[model samples]
Target: MTNLSQNSDIADDEYLSAFYRCAYGHLATVVGTGHQPSRTVEIGSGRGLARLSGHSWWHSDVLPSEALTLRNSAERLPFHDQSLDALILKDTWHHIPDIEAFLDEAHRVLRVGGTIAVFDPYWGILARFVYRFLHQERWDTRTPQWSFPSTDPWDSNQALTYMMLRRDREDFHRRWGDRFVLTEYQRHIGPSFLLSGGVSRRTAVSGAWLKRLLSWEERRGPWFDHFRFFHVFGLVKQ
Candidate 1:
């Protein structure tokens, strides 16, 4: 119900940054590279929080401007063969028109030892319920019809659903084979209102006091972690 497009606040960026940090941590563990990657890239950089600005070399999305260094779609990455050490796609996989092409592109662009990390929605029990009930998201069962400038249809015309978490991660392992090794398939957010209550921008009240409280609460580790809203897959290009 909350219009995320219009809710351009610093807290949104904060939440996004938190999610990115979690994704990056999981990715680093999966890569097993020990050292931080010196050369990395990301698809769907969006507002740029995923860039890990100060921690790594960051490139803004490709544009005609001279300042921009990378510019290409996920399906056809512009990089040369075997050029990257790491690639990350946060919340971008579902938007991709063709998963096979995107994976092929990833395999082509990544170096033999490079890693590709995807942090996508899992659509488990919680997410399925929330999207089908409270939110406007098109369920995982349907193909995308309307493109942009529109809310999720939540229409019941699903034909080819991609249940990112419901299916076995081995499916991808078999598909990618030796070209890429699937290292991790994790359900990160572990469960909570994310599946039942709609994830609105208002979920976190932005105040100095509330943030401190939330951080403190996180340290306590409540029982609701079983249904957190995100899932991740980490793979390495062999």
Candidate 2:
């Protein structure tokens, strides 16, 4: 298992930077099409991409850090009711102890027509293999539900996103359709991220070539379902 502390270095690596650029770019594009909220915030702000983009939002995490503007829990957001235009959760949902509470808090904080964007790893066949054998996080695909059994906010089941958003998609829609509108959901491949050795190993790809590869992948969007390792989903408060 790779060390989480290495994330800071990985974010600066040239090969991985290309991956971040592409991923963040895609996120920016999707959020751009939504209502431009005056106030937004990103939970689990690793590299603080949302802040770096000049957005009017705060970057927060559970642990205080130099990169984050606030420290808070996902289940209990520190925001006033109907005050935020958007909430971004990148690679964070699986780590939350209570998905229902987090969603409820997000809905309560967001103004009418506010957006919620989430980008997370998808637990498909390839992701199952990679996360189970190669990554540090738990990848229990047999888990029957999305919420975690533990109270520890950091305790994670990486498969929860896939289970809730894909495997049990109809149930999710039936449950939350009244409060939130599902705007977009897409599966994508991050060959660059894989080749960059993530946060632990040495990089195996160059930035320029990785960019070209990502561009090609973008062009072949339909092929994503066959090789999906990550997913992006957007929702709007109703």
Candidate 3:
């Protein structure tokens, strides 16, 4: 990537950092002291959006270290049964080609009362339109209809499947309801104008007006909630 303007990288890092900070903060709220399991794993810790924590085990797809572990595929996690206190899948569920198998494995490995937390886009009215028009990827309210192979993960045509929302909480509840307890639900809107691209010289200078526009849209109206905005859900194993 080309060198961006001063503090551009910092700005991006801060953006990701804030995401992790907020996720962990919310995860901590519902997960009480002992409710936290002996181990914590992050399924797709790409670029470290959700940092490894000190309280429990930390793992990611990148940045391997003694404290952090890496897994290549979500369908088959590299761990034993009932071994984790929690598993965080931040903005990664839509990318899982075999979400059913993946969640099944999560249920099998999570100790009774273990937590499975997910953060992803909810295809409400705003989300559906923004993703379909604003981005190249098409928004599909359905799940796993597109062909997704296990070995080569990136081969999917929908490179950025941002539109695959889980329909509703009751939907996921009906699936994992027996095995896990749904604990929390929260929503978020983001740096709307920032979009997702490497900063270039032309757009290097961050504009105050751009930030203001984002601020305005975040509080735009109650109708905004009807759109596919960001959402977080946490479930504890039964």
lDDT of each: 0.54, 0.73, 0.56
Question: After superposing candidate 2, which stretches have Cα over 4 Å from the reference?
Answer: 1-12, 33-38, 51-56, 150-154
lDDT of 3 at 197: 24
| Model 2 lDDT, full chain set | 0.73
Enumerate clash totals for all models, in the order shown. 12, 0, 7
TM-score for all models, in order of appearance: 0.68, 0.85, 0.68
Over all chains combined, what TM-score does candidate 2 have? Answer: 0.85
Q: List the residue pairs that clash in candidate 3.
A: 37-85, 122-228, 124-227, 124-228, 125-227, 126-227, 127-228
Model 2 per-residue lDDT tens digits across residues 56-175? 457788866666777898888999999887788878878887888999999999999888888888766666788888887788778787777875556798888777777888999899
Q: After superposition, how far is residue 2 of candidate 2 from its true place, in Å?
A: 25
Better of 2 and 3 by TM-score: 2
Q: What is the lDDT of candidate 3?
A: 0.56
Off by over 4 Å in 1: 1-8, 11-17, 32-38, 51-53, 58-69, 142-165, 168-171, 190-200, 203-225
Can you write out model 3's per-residue Cα lDDT over 1-238, one digit (the tens) per residue? 1122332343455333343455556556545565543487777655443333233435555324333456467778788999887887766676677777777888888888888877665555656566556654445545444335544443332322232224344555665678777667666555442342212222443444444444565565655666425666677888
Most accurate candidate by TM-score: 2
Which residue pairs come into collision in candidate 2? Answer: none
Candidates 2 and 3 compared by lDDT, better number = 2
